[model samples]
Target chain A: MFAGAAAALLVALVLALARAVLGPTVFDRVQAANTVGTLAMLLLAVIGFLTGRPDFLDLALVYGLLNVLGTFAVLKFFRYGDLGDPGEDEEHHT
Target chain B: MNTVVDILSWGFLLAGGAFCAIGALGLVRMPDFYTRMHAAGVTDTLGAGLMLFGMMLQAGLSLVTVKLIMIGLLIFFTSPSATHALARAARARGLQPLLATGKGPSKRS
Candidate 1:
């Protein structure tokens, strides 16, 4: 059963990859990348269960954290053109 | 009782996987970026949650279950925030959503 779930997740991952490749805009690609990260985390968990290595759950947890962080980072970068920009709140800093 | 648990776990995993695939298909098929984000949200929330729930059932009161819950919580909280940020960024950049205004897809500006 776990194997079946893992296979399905693999299929989903491929479809998401296609979107990332064919995405017309940068935001589309970013969204696709975020979805890919999520699917990969789920795949890690399912595969870990199938292979009898419960330790993989820990890895999944870490992947999930990194996935969201990566999404936010990318969005921030696109919005501000730099990761460290303080947005419109800070003025007269010339 | 054990058989019942097994069956439930299998069902959950199966449903979760199917939902994930369907959501991905929507991501590919949806026309607008905002609509695509709507589709992606399905996989992020429902697909991930159901799969983790199934895994927890299989783990049966172990550390594995706790870890699964943590991952679920992480996705649950962060997915919306990320999606919100994405939408805001797109809007700030003047990417208008495809709206069904009038006789065809029209921009809301």
Candidate 2:
């Protein structure tokens, strides 16, 4: 069952990769990349079970947190041209 | 008793995998980015939740189950925030969503 789930996740990862490659805009690419990160995290967990190493769940948890952070950081950079920029609301402080 | 748990775990895992695949298909087939975001949301939330739930059943009251729950909670809280940020950024940058009126975003591929 773990093997089956892993295979299906691999298929999903490939499809998401195709979107990332074929994306017409940067936003599309970012979105696809986010999806890919998510699929990869799930795959990691499933493969851990398939290989009898439950320790991989810790890795999966870390990956999930990173995925969310990375997505937000990239989007902020794309929007404001800088990650540290506080946007218009805090421009006065700078 | 053990057999029933195993059966239920397998079923959940299978259903989760199927949902993940279908969502990825939608990601590929959707006409635009916003629609694709909708599809990806399915994979992020439903796919991850169900699969983790299945794994929890298999773990059967262990620290592994605790870690799984932590992961689920992280995804549950952050996925929507990321999606919302992405959509807001895309819109602010003038990437209009495709509307039903047949006039899609003016930006071309």
Candidate 3:
């Protein structure tokens, strides 16, 4: 069962990668990249279970945190052209 | 009891995998960036949630299960934030969402 899940996730990851590569817009690629990160995290967890190595779960957790941080960093850079900027324009919308 | 657990795990894993695959398909097939974000959201939420839940069940009351829950929580909290940031950035940059007419792109002034 874990094997099946892993295989499906692999296929999904490839599809997401394809979308990222074929993007007509920057947002599309970022979205796809985020999806890819999510799938990778899932894959890591499933593989840990399959291998009976529970320690892999730690790695998955770290990866998930990194994924979010990376996305935010990239979006910040894209929006304000600098990660340090407060994204003031972004705040006005919300 | 063991058999029951096995069955439950299998069911969750399969369902999660199916959702993940379907979401990825949507990502490829969706007409616009906003729609594609919706697709990826599906995989990020339901797909990852179910899969991690199954792993938690398999791990039972152990540190592994604790770690799995932590990972799930992380994804739950961050996925939406990231998606929101992406959408907000796109909108702020003047990238308009596709309209319902499905005819052509429209920008908001």
Give Cα-based local distance difference scores for all models.
Answer: 0.90, 0.89, 0.89
Q: Which stretches of candidate 3 lie over 4 Å from their true place?
A: A89-94, B102-109
Candidate 1, superposed: residue stretches over 4 Å from native:
A88-94, B103-109
* C-alpha DockQ of every model: 0.83, 0.79, 0.85
Candidate 3 residue lDDT tens string, A1-94: 8999999999899899999999989989999999999999999999898898877788888888888888999998988899888656565676
Model 2 C-alpha lDDT versus the unseen true structure: 0.89
- The chain B TM-scores of all candidates, as shown, are 0.92, 0.91, 0.90
TM-score of each: 0.92, 0.92, 0.92
Q: Residue B88: error of model 2 in Å?
A: 0.1
Model 3 residue pairs with clashes: none
Give per-residue CA lDDT, model 2, range B1-109, as digits (tens).
9999999999999888988988898889898999999999989988988999998899999998898899889888888888898999999999989877557754443
Residue-wise C-alpha lDDT for candidate 3, range B48-100, written one tens digit per residue: 98888887778889888888889888988889999999999999999988766
The complex in candidate 3 yields a DockQ of 0.85
Residue A46, model 2: lDDT of: 87
Q: Which digits, one per residue and each the tens of the lDDT, describe model 1 over residues A1-79?
A: 9999998899999999999999799999999999999999999999899999988888888888888888888888999
* DockQ for candidate 1, C-alpha atoms: 0.83
Sequence-dependent TM-score of model 3: 0.92
Which prediction has the highest DockQ against the true structure? 3
Residues forming the 10-long window of minimal summed lDDT in candidate 1 chain A: A85-94
